[model samples]
Target: MPPAHPFDFGAIDDDEGDTLHEECGVFGVIGVTDAANFVALGLHALQHRGQEAGGIVTHAPDVGFQSVRRFGYVRDNFTDPETMAMLPGQLGIGHVRYSTAGSKGQTAIRDVQPFFGEFAMGGAAIAHNGNITNANALRRELIERGSIFQSSSDSECIIHLMARSLQKTIPDRMEDALRRVEGAFSIVAMTRTKLIGVRDPLGVRPLVLGRIGDGWALSSETCALDIIGAEFIREIEPGEMIVITDKGIESTYPFRPKRPRFCIFEHVYFSRPDSILGGRSVYETREAIGRELAKEAPVEADLVCPVPDSGTPAAIGFSLESGIPYAMGIIRNQYMGRTFIEPTEQIRNMGVRLKLNVNRALIRGKRVILVDDSVVRGTTSRKIKEMILDAGAREVHFRIASPPTAWPCFYGVDTPQREKLLAATMSEEEMRDHLQVDSLRFISLDGLYRAVGESRGRDASAPQYCDACFSGEYPVEPADMVEQGFRPKTAAE
Candidate 1:
């Protein structure tokens, strides 16, 4: 049988011109009846991680394996009974995605994962989160060695590498494939009888294990587990791989040990507040960040206001710590998806107004402190400042939960290049002037570490988390990017 052509229904083009884009989310389950249904629910909870496309691959004893890939939101496609009916199995893996490594437009459907490969050992479907920085170099080598590529995704390189491995078992082959690869990866893969989960040596992305009845599941966040009524087991440790079968789960350490560099932004903006990460509630961590921000960057304001949803918890913490009353100054439109996930500037600008509006009554004659997750391009911040001032805010003070994002992220989060980042090119005063805020303050890097339970603060030599976006100290060397003349931006620059 010939391969199925990539599905390209109409494109869903919403724009997020100023915010950072999340990489992708992966989910897998084994030993369950109607496994695809649980995977759908898990994907729904992780929809915020990637809004562009979603795909699921499932294997059944009698029916073999099936896959369904689509462009647009998961709820739009995967929620339907008709779509779910096409995918039925005892073992399944799914992915919700935004392309950081592939082309855009209708053709991008080819890059939507969980990519399946029919290896000589049988069939394996892999769903990956986090970028493979050295993918191009590997791709060239693989192509030269007579490997035919299917998709433009960096992730496809893994499948090709696995095909050539001398290992007998699928798990061993996968481990062999990953050993040759570099950069951050948190992967969930499914074979006929087993579900496999692996996190990279530094664990730049998150992958967690869960239990549902007698079945086992792996997901990008604990929130996905909650949606499927799965009991949280524990996080998949860095450099670790787990293979789950009906018999039991087997663990393997495939990579040399290293200090884990979990992405700290997960607590700041990527994760849902309801999720737990690194053994702590993400909501509590953000709240602590807000309290720390208040201590480090105090300002006299009449009302402490969050930028809605993402900033609400931190704003509440700021209010408690600073003795300022909290109010709903900026009201988010619950009906709209995130503006940052949109693909164009024009649509993103329109989305900002459709997504958020100021509460005139709450802000009128008040010195409002706007607590936001982070400022990227300064476009959204500028627009919000204008909206607040127009609504009769006496003064608008900006407080950011995370430190200024000054560097691009290669390990998953889709940050702009250094030249495009507002912080990368401007000082705090310059950013304040550009955004036209009365004052702009970001939480210190030490404060962020403290909030995430690192009381002694970040060590310059060995940081606790992957803070490359703020500190420019990458845990993994970006070999491919460096070869292309990508240089890390210095603070002075």
Candidate 2:
């Protein structure tokens, strides 16, 4: 068969089915020269958050509102001079999507974001990261009240709600819309002359403000700001919204603020290592997690090897803390895309090995300690373990940076069904046996909190960050999931 078209994302199977995926990334800029270009760069930096599809919306007096939504990476779709020229504007917003809701593997163009809505005042386009827990109920209610939706995306619910609002300004309409919303959201929206950003009351996802030249930018991560040479201004506080235009910026708390419970996973894996989260370096935090793991679960091993890329920082810390030699025991093929086709069945069965090969020279006869960010399904971990043993390793040990993910994340992360999550079904010992590793250990939930700067660890009275995936103590009720018969953890559980 010939290579499928890039935008034919539905035809492709996910290459990284074992890992969690963030729903999307949002970026917007105002008053910059060709702001769309800056948004593109910002989106490119945030490609790790979402790789399935991307969209950019730009507004100029000449063009009014112009948008391009396409499947595949930003570089693949948005870098062309012709495409960039078409998006000419001094204000723009963009989204890169990995489907958490809507069409699953088979994404339609309509589902790709920077969703635009026409209002009585003007047209506004909004790019949103994070999932709306009450989207289904809201969607049903909105449809009953005569709101027509254009896409299967939950984020589009906001646009429709904005349309129905009695408020005069777009920002006011958004506040009205979001006040009715339940679940996590970090939004970057653009009107003809304004750029706006808002974080959900819980701040379950990330949104940062940055300054680039005379203009300002809002992005999902500070790393994105670095990509566009934007100075990090600070994170958008939970429940806060900022409207930026030539007159400068105005900030407000649209929703009642609750105790902040930012997504802890952003520190573990979702964010770029170079990014800063809650005034701490993501890389440094991961390193701290490794150090904590070493102290908590001390293991004797000949070599401490990272699972590659994401695992490297933690592995370095583990090696330093444990006084074990650090080596690259597994090598990743950097050029490989998440999905690829193999001509033969034999080649197809190679699976994870096609993407990661065991570094035999380093693995042979060595008791290797493999440090990985997280284990979701355990399929990838099992396969990697087998590859290591096949390469003549003396023993294989698995050190996971985060605690086991036992619950599905409803707030913007693409997670497997609860039953499908290996951690959800198995205990630590059972998981170790299932993977057939000599030993396996995950950083304790408290240890993870300490890594992220909670020196005394997670406070049971009121946990600081969202660790629902590990602890099953959801800070926000997943209304949509509960309506579908999903169970929440009881006190005993």
Candidate 3:
């Protein structure tokens, strides 16, 4: 059978189904020839990091700073001839946001960031990715100190800290404030004359600095650098602050040093295959996972095929190691949009099917090895398996690129509670039975860490990767699950 076409049917909203719980993506550029254009281009690459809304804050010599933000995709909101004409500046910062803190309320334009603020010292605007676990605690402290907040996001807490600090420089003020905050974060703040970037001490999120001629760019992923024509320098050290100004890029470390815990999920799921994070290539890392999986759990199959997109690289690695021919067994619908569908359970299910379809020509009567990045709820994987069977695949052998997720994530990614994870409740054999696959395998935790060219011991890269989702070892536990509204339902209670 021929490969299925990837066009969206418009039958369901493009934004339907399971999502990567990304907090946001941040971009900033200074000393660039066309700073606005570079920011637009950078935001476009980081669009996958967010989709709720997008905005840019540009500095104007006469007017100070001006911004244009709209609640929509980057391509949908900015960069037209008219919008581009309005955004004028040589130094600018941009953001694409997903609702972690403010998703419950209105998708208000005000909640969207590059959150512009006016202070006695100077005005500043910030774009942030990651959640502050202690935001409520911090908010109460600020309120007691007589500080007023404009946004509900924990990100607002930082600005309040900045306002209260007596430090002479913006970096010092940020460093002073960051010292008091906890949880995962990568922040981009724009002042009248400087662009300030800060990452949490643990480095639970990603941040990188790139350079092109005299221009300096900071972004959440190296893919953005590739888009904006910036050379990938190196990751901003796990607990470092970088201040970009006309004087050039200055680096600082105000927080006490801690092991870098760059989120491993970036390589497993979040980052683009072309990106390089924490000094390792994402594409190569994923492939290594496949190779490691084949070594760890060899399966008898006629051909190896990935789930498409995220699963392809690992599938290739699996094929190389297992010596099976790799094939494109599934085709994803390209036309899906988040606002394309109305919110209803039935509608959402239909949306998932429209997003993915099996290629009958490729799988009929063949023993197939199915590859995927991770199995979250197992619903998506189950559906894809059923589709492959419907396409006449004789047997579906399932292999995952990373270890089974057994815990919830607090730093950023919105993984379901522990009970929702298939592996957490069931053994591998049980999971195979539930999904009705011929066999099942997942990469080991140690192997996954090594696949990225680092071991899990001393001298490991991304030492602070919040692996709680896969290992049940959280960096910091919530005060109480019930207080956070994540308590599980008892079988009888």
Candidate 4:
């Protein structure tokens, strides 16, 4: 055979330096009729987790396995009759992605996942939801050994590792592959007759199991289970792997157990309000954050208003706790997606106007309190405050649901560099003046843990959740980034 061509990793633009981004979402189903349809619905519900592209891989008798990958929303691609017609099977897996580890232009479609590989044993399709910090280092080693690659995504590293494994069974090979990997991961994979799910030892990301009649489903959140009329069973524990076959589901612990470090930001912004995370309703958790903020930083304002959608739940809690009337002072455009994901600052600035508008009639001459999840660059918050003031508000006070984001997250979240973060360089008073509001306050770090059901507050020596962005204490060292001379901001800084 001729020499295999190497995959081009340099084509990817790794410098996404403006906003925080969730990695991706994965869903899988087995022992269900029309499994592709259910997987589509699950991916639809998870579209919030990732919006750039989506794909579904399915296995069936006689027809073998088929896939449909598209470069837009799930509803736009997977819901089409023509597209669904191409995918028919009883076992399926899917992914919705926002490209934390791949390029950002048209070539990005190559990275759209549910990545499939044909090994000597059979075919395995895998969809991953987190980042591998050592992917570049591993990719270099693989290429030096004459291993050609297909996609630019860090996820492809798993396939290459599995291919090189000497293990006989696919699950054995998978475990062997994961043992050599580092960083956060929640993976859903499928063989010819079985579906598999696994979470990293740290449990930095989320993956849950559900039951749909006689079938079993694995999803990134409980909301996906609700979308497909599935009963919530339980979360796939960290270091645990479940293989769902015709016989039943078999559980195995592949890695050594460690303390769980679930992402705290999930409750703040990533998860849907309707979802359940860490055995608590995400909506209730966010509301509790608002109430805690009210206790820590009370403001005597006439009206409380939210940035809309993500901030609505928290704002309601703030109003109830502070006895201020909640009003829809800012109306968001239902058609607009999130602005922070936009690649350029100019587009992000334009997106604010297209995405939200001020209710001039309600804000004129009234003291308004603006409730938002978190501020990164202070661009949107500053713009919103200006808009409120131009609408004749007597005073504009800003209340944030989470503590200041001073450090960059290297596990999976696409946070800007520490130097680019507004809080990394400015004092609280400086940030207040920078946004140009009457007053500005963020929830204290301990206040956030209290809202999340930690009554004793955050333990400095042993944190309950991954609050690295707020606290600057990373559970997992970003080895690859550290080698690249990327120094994280210390808490003392």
Candidate 5:
């Protein structure tokens, strides 16, 4: 493809680190008039969550459960008439995966998900999002008892556990299986006549249930509901399970449940602006963060501009609170893929310019307030600050909505080492100099919680949130996981 663009990665900055780990995106449909089509549409909306591989498995009276998968984007892998025609059924499940536990080099059609396994007990097809913290330990235990593993995913651990359970019915076995897993996960598994969805005990990931006429759908985000014309239903409670069939949907929880600890990063960096999470609007939550930022770190500037996409709502709130006009000071190129790990420095440097550009007309000669969700390594922010100054911004005042990320995340996010994080090593003034900005302010940790807690209908007042990346109190100890950092390894190194 003509060597791609030089600005694709090198010119980009390491400050573009993902704040949290995302396992994959999941979509399931039952009783839908066009189950395969609905799954296809839902997977399209969740495309940003993962891009390594995609697949769907469907169940019908004639074929039971038929599936097709390939290592590519959903549009490229599942768009053909031949592929879609093979997945005919009124019930189905889909998955888009970005590997966390296994080597991406081993990626093949067989390894792509909706893993179908048949045994003396029953047959099931499963798709999962989020990593199971106990997967490696559990996998070792399962292997000792004669369960053969066909894939390198933690997801297969659940199915093997379900197989080992002595329960006679599928629901009972599923319940037994879930109680054994720990960490963040939203799973959808289907059989010939039944479909089931389950969330981890802490509910660190998002999963919602929706209904469209007689058909029912379950997804990782409300955006899927919008795509399929499904009416909004409540979110799946932490430690809850729902079973769906032609008879309708039924809920259950057979394990001792814990309070929900939804990943706070979802509200900050992930999720679409139009979506609602934990009974709160995502956009409003971010705006509240911005409002709190203005109160906590009032800045002097003529106008406020967000990083684009994720930073827009917070920028708007900051502008309103500070009485600074919000303008489109930076424009994002939506077509640019994520550049967090572009191989070369030159490519990473070019990435900053390709991903976003300073709108000179809006920012020139103004005292600009630049707001972004979070800063990781500080490379891109530095480049951006230099770009704006070159464009005639008199002074650049930087504002961040979240506290400094000093710790690495083990849940599923691919964060780097502690030393690599800018906030962990640099003083506030040092960061300003590093980014070449006039002034800088980061929101306090308490302000973030208050923003969510005080929102009108959110009831975010008392949610158990995973703030380990911001604070040092990780729900689970991850000292052993320090060796698993994302520092690209080479043969000689």
Candidate 6:
């Protein structure tokens, strides 16, 4: 096999990365020899959550601190013995990132995390997994108050806030800093000997704990712990923080308690199928969504097919519930990662075909129902429909597992501008017309809730999960964007 090509992030523009991007993933471990190695494996497992860049920060009392921040995949960067050897320590934290509230594609090394800060007490490094909604305002305030920033990322503000805190302990200072901050966050941090984990008040993003024999570990998902042969513990409660050391772990709550509004999209598309979230299997939930979609939008089709990978479980559920045969109508080039080097305009125009191709023999002459998670800008959907038509499919019907994504996510996920969102601008019928499909139907919000085990469905007054992108019900206000003339949803709009 040829060596992996470097990620040429700048060439393609104009909704090339049309799908919704994940925020980031965080992991840390303590009481283990060469803890950074464990952190690297955990990060590699959670790499699906973020692939642009990765970083690890380790702490050894004698060696002080060792950090290695690099661009691209963890397997290519952190897995090398030489690089791992440089990160020797009993306590360490790591972050796998996608550009959200930071510089987009071609990420700077400074923007890569775990971001380290030298406090009066000792140095602390934080690996944050969510977006900060109020970052712009805080940055202006911090800058005015003599806080010089090194990176454009919103997460860097937490470090500045920590540096200004008067609290004696690093965790205490973190609490003080977090108290003033807002929006979704699940953070993993480390000092000299202690490893820390924290979730925002709403638990909008995921963070879990695990037991690593004589050590303890924290990760963005349980699947990561499984990669390192660690026994799963429990999810760190929303608004709670855990500080772990050689002896044991201590838990604390810094933010006030509220209804946990975990991101609902995690079950729909973001998380790995093997991961368990909210006491439910992510894979099972997706299957349920497909069942619900089939029940709600029963379509007559010769074959039920997934858009490959993310859409597979749902397609199986659709097939099971609808009595249609499930087939691999589309095949993904597994080696072609999310970030690939599109060197020429011809290859760039190939677009979705580079990553996906229709299983021509299977799709030809069939009324195919393509089950996909969601349609963002409809760029990929259009290309997919064209491919299916070119392959001689009699009809193409789209069944989305999640509700129409009409609003931009302010919590963590990187989303297109409101006007750029196909759902935001077009009704379901209009979207169908635009895609030139036989039919396009998305699962209802209530159906989505039920799929995720919310038997009662969504409560208009108080939703159980963060359906901000679907319902425009933001749990936390996006302050900075509002200041810049970005408006929240209104009843009339």
Tens digit of per-residue lDDT, candidate 3, span 241-260: 98888888788887888876
lDDT of 2 at 117: 89
Clashes of each: 5, 1, 10, 0, 18, 0
C-alpha lDDT values of all predictions: 0.87, 0.87, 0.78, 0.85, 0.78, 0.87
lDDT of 4 by residue, 54-76 (tens): 99999998788899999878998
Give the Å shift of residue 160 in candidate 2: 0.4
Model 2 collision count: 1
lDDT of 2 by residue, 223-273 (tens): 999988999999999999999999999999979869888999999989999
Error of 1 at 50 (Å): 0.4
lDDT of 6 at 139: 86
Q: 162-185 in candidate 6: lDDT tens per residue? A: 999899999999999999898888
Model 2: how large is the Cα RMSD against the reference? Answer: 3.9
Which candidate model has the greater lDDT, 5 or 6? 6
- Stretches of model 6 off by over 4 angstroms after superposition: 1-15, 338-342, 455-463
Per-residue lDDT for 195-243 in model 1, tens only?
Answer: 9999999998999999999999999999999989999999999999999
TM-score of every model? 0.94, 0.95, 0.90, 0.93, 0.88, 0.95
Candidate 5: residue 3 lDDT (0-100): 10
Off by over 4 Å in 3: 1-19, 101-105, 339-347, 458-464, 477-493
Say which prediction, candidate 2 or candidate 3, comes out ahead on lDDT: 2
- Where model 1 places Cα greater than 4 Å from the true spot, the runs are 1-15, 338-351, 455-463, 489-493
